[model samples]
Target: MSDPVDFRDNRGVGTLISDLIQQVSSLMQTEIRLLRAEMGDKLKTMLGGAVEVLAGGLLLMAALLILLQALVVALAHWVGAGWASLIVGLVVAVIGVILVKRGTSNIEPSNLTPDQTTNQLARDAAVVKEQFK
Candidate 1:
């Protein structure tokens, strides 16, 4: 990545303008590359979170199945066993829901936005404009 142009020489006006354009173009390209890299990193993180959500969903489904099957069978035999099974299933379901929520937040639009890269570009633009003044 190239630094912003520092035009302090007694160069021709046209040459200076051309150099400035080139430097600005280089800066833009560099920022774009950085943005792409940042986006890629976010996507990978989101994907990992998505996997967690999927696993959580599976756990949720299993917990529900456990609750249904256990309650139906255990209730016929003993009230105490049925209550214990229900408690265990509810605990598992709660854990699954928490996992899903955490994973969902990881993929949220707020989390995915390339705020750092955007801010960096803005700072670079301000510096270049300052030099212009």
Candidate 2:
């Protein structure tokens, strides 16, 4: 017959195996936490860069709009018919709207949700293709 197993002594290997399992679990949890922290830091940096780029782009757009408005005003004054000036301003405004819409539509935000990004890209592509034709 096989020897009877001892239940009360430290010599049994069950305790050692349990300790090893626990150690491995703790290490895994630590690694996961570290990975999460690293990913969060990288996301923060990316978002900050995106925000800076967006701010700069908006500032440039504002300056361009102001310049366009000044040009429209000067043209209106030089042309000298009240109705003509109104028509010219309206046409310029419409053209400006179209250009701005096309310009901003091309800007892709990298951090958008996957579905939103895909949908926006598909829509923009369709619009651009239609515009080209």
Candidate 3:
């Protein structure tokens, strides 16, 4: 009868180590690819939101201009045309300043950071450390 094969031999250990190395390498590559895809998706979403906000801001500016002109016209009956225009312009300028301040406050460096990716990477590192240990 043919000899039975020995499964837990030294050669088997070497093969297992080789397979482990290859698998770990492949896992790292897949993780990197996933990270890139996720970041790309996030960037696209952020860009789309920015475009929408820009369009809304432009429309709001147009509407504000029309309203300011209407206010000046209405005030002209009570005040002289020059004073009405000046008052309306001042009010619009003040409102614009307030809006600019609020808009700026909403935009900070932290808001632009890739928070999900950062968290995911930290988790991945922890898992790798545990696996190796």
Q: Find the candidate with the highest lDDT and give its number.
A: 1
Per-prediction TM-score: 0.83, 0.41, 0.57
Give the higher-lDDT candidate: 1 or 2.
1
Full ranking by lDDT: 1, 3, 2
Candidate 2 weakest ten by summed lDDT: 104-113
- Candidate 1: which pairs clash? none
Worst 10 residues of 3 by lDDT: 102-111
Candidate lDDT values, in order: 0.90, 0.57, 0.65
Write one digit per residue (lDDT tens) for candidate 1, span 70-107: 78968698767777888889988999999899899898
lDDT of 1 at 73: 66
Clashes of each: 0, 0, 0
Off by over 4 Å in 1: 1-8, 79-84
Cα TM-score of candidate 2: 0.41
Cα RMSD of predicted structure 1: 5.0
